[model samples]
Every structure is written in C-alpha cells, then in structure tokens.
Target: MSGRLSATVVQQCVVSLGDVRTRIDVSIKRRFLADQDRVYPGLECPVPNDDTVELLSSVIDLYGLTREVLLLEIPSYPRLEGATVPDSGGSNSGQDQDQTDGHPFAVLSEFRERMAK
Candidate 1:
C-alpha cells in the first residue's frame, strides 16, 4: 500500500520578519513481514507507546510513523541570523559573548578560583 499526506503549518521564519507558512508532504509504503525481530537497514523500527513489548501484533504503518517523524523533526525554536529578543525592561541584556574562536573552558577560570579556597 502506498499513500501520501500533505499539510500546511505556520512556522517561525528562519530568515524573515514574520511567521512563514510551510507545506509538508509525506509518502508511505507498506511492507509485509512475518518476523518482527528481523532488522531492516535504512528503516526505522516502530516506536512503542509504553513499556509493553508488543510483538508482530502490530503492523508497520508508515503514515502514522511519518506524522510522528515530522513532529520530531520540527525545530522548537527558529530564529534568523542576528535575531535578538526584545528586552522586557531588564537591567542586563541576555546577549551571549562572541566565543566562536575562543575556548569554551574560558568560563571555568572563575570556578577554579572559587575551588582554590
């Protein structure tokens, strides 16, 4: 069995000033199997809902898996280059230092000094 699913969703634009609309298209193919323990390369196994190990009692449904995969793949936070959040009247701005080339361990200097006590 083969089927396609399409949807339109509003997602934060990664390069624009406003929310951007996106369309997602997915196609699924059904495969019949007898043994559930058989490993298939390049294919994802069915995700279980709980601790129950339900064997071949369940058939592999690609459409349901595709929706779950799409949800998992969506970014939680999307921001454009150089995008900065508006200050809410706070004393300190939440800007991070430019440490692209610098070492991440540089911040450990303060901890090392405190530990010396």
Candidate 2:
C-alpha cells in the first residue's frame, strides 16, 4: 500500500533556542513481499531508495511513520533570516558589531598555533 503524509511541527533553533516552524510533506510507497530476500521489478520503498527501512510483516505503523518523517524533515539548525548567532565571547553587540571581518574562532586558531609551536 502507498499514500501521502503531511505534518506541521515547531522545532527549537540550534543557536537562538527559539521556535522554528517546519512543514513535512512526503509521498510514501511501499511494496511488501512475501518473506523475500530482495524486492523485484524496479522496487520502490516508502522512504528514499538510499535510505530505506524494511517494514516487518504485513502491517505498517502510520503514527510512527508520520513521526519519523517529521523528525527527518525538521532542520538541525533553523535560523531566522538576518538573525546572527552570537560569538563565543558572549559579547552582545546588539547587531551593531561588524562580525563579517574578524576571525570568529581566533582563540581556537591561536591555541592550534601554540600547540604546533
């Protein structure tokens, strides 16, 4: 059996720790064979071909499948446009600081150089 699935969820931003709204829409098509080692005739799986999860038995969990889809669709790091992640120094420039030029991880670089020395 095959069908479509859609979900709406809110995820926390990686940097800002704010709510990030996300939508998941996917086409699910699964072919269950009778205790077969491999699928045949140009087989198509519910998930992507590269990432396929074989379903056990004749039953499929719709709720679990929906949750899985939503988890995959959500971004690992969701940042708003024009929003900037504060540097490690914890200095709040309030958007006035020109962060485009200076070395963001200068301390790490310095530590690496010192180790080499």
Candidate 3:
C-alpha cells in the first residue's frame, strides 16, 4: 500500500529559543505476506524487505504506524531563522557558575576515568 502524510508544526530553536515553522511529509509503503505454516531450508537468511510486513491480524494499526513515522521525521534539534549559535556553548554555557559539580553522574564519570587510566 501507498499513502501520504502532511502536517505543519511549530518548532522551537534550541539555540535562540525562537519559533520555527516546519513542514512534515511522509510517504508510506507496506507489503503483507501470506501465512507461513512452515519454514524450509533457505539459501542464506531470508531477510524481509524494509517495506514488507506480516499480516497476522485482520486489523492494521494505522495510528501506531503513523505516530512512529512522525516521531522519526520530527527534528530532535531545531535552529531558528538568522540566529547565530555559538559552537562552544552547551545547555548551561551562558551561566556564570561551574556546572560540573552539580552533574548527577559526576562521581560515576570520575570512577570511569580512573578505571580507564
């Protein structure tokens, strides 16, 4: 089967904390095979196609599939229009205080480093 998904989403800029308009377009393709009662000796491993799926149930989970595809298409990090992001900056780089002491895994990290040496 073939289908299309189109949506407009407002995303935030990770660096400048500004709004960004994003458009999502996803093309869906899927194939369902017949019931396999038995598996014979195959020539090498029988790898299913990326677009192929087994139709075991009578109903297809369209909502679940669409949600998964949307999650993949959405950007994890977004940038604002004309906003300059500092290369060396991190989440708390703009703050004056040292953040190393407050990190949750600092002790674990130190232990790991000592083990590495």
Scored by lDDT, the top model is: 3
User: Whole-model lDDT, candidate 1?
Assistant: 0.57
Stretches of candidate 2 off by over 4 Å are: 37-58, 90-117
Using TM-score, give the best candidate's number. 3
* Evaluation by lDDT, superior candidate among 2 and 3: 3
- Alpha-carbon lDDT, every model: 0.57, 0.64, 0.71
Residue 105, candidate 2: C-alpha displacement in angstroms: 12
Model 3, residue 68: displacement in angstroms? 1.2
Q: State each candidate's clash count.
A: 0, 0, 0
Backbone clash tally for model 2?
Answer: 0
What are the per-residue Cα lDDT tens digits for candidate 2 across 17-104? 7777777788876554444335554555334354444546767777777677667777778875566766665432545246534766
Please provide TM-scores, in order, for all candidate models, with all chains considered together. Answer: 0.41, 0.54, 0.58
TM-score of 1: 0.41
* Window of ten residues with lowest summed lDDT in model 2: 91-100
Candidate 1 C-alpha lDDT tens digits along 6-88: 77777875655567556678764444444434656556666555422323535565556667757854666666556676655
Model 2 TM-score (2 dp): 0.54
Which digits, one per residue and each the tens of the lDDT, describe model 3 over residues 20-116?
Answer: 8889998977676544543334435454766447555568788977787788888898887788866566444545226564786655766788899
Regions more than 4 Å wrong, model 1 = 13-17, 36-63, 72-100, 105-117
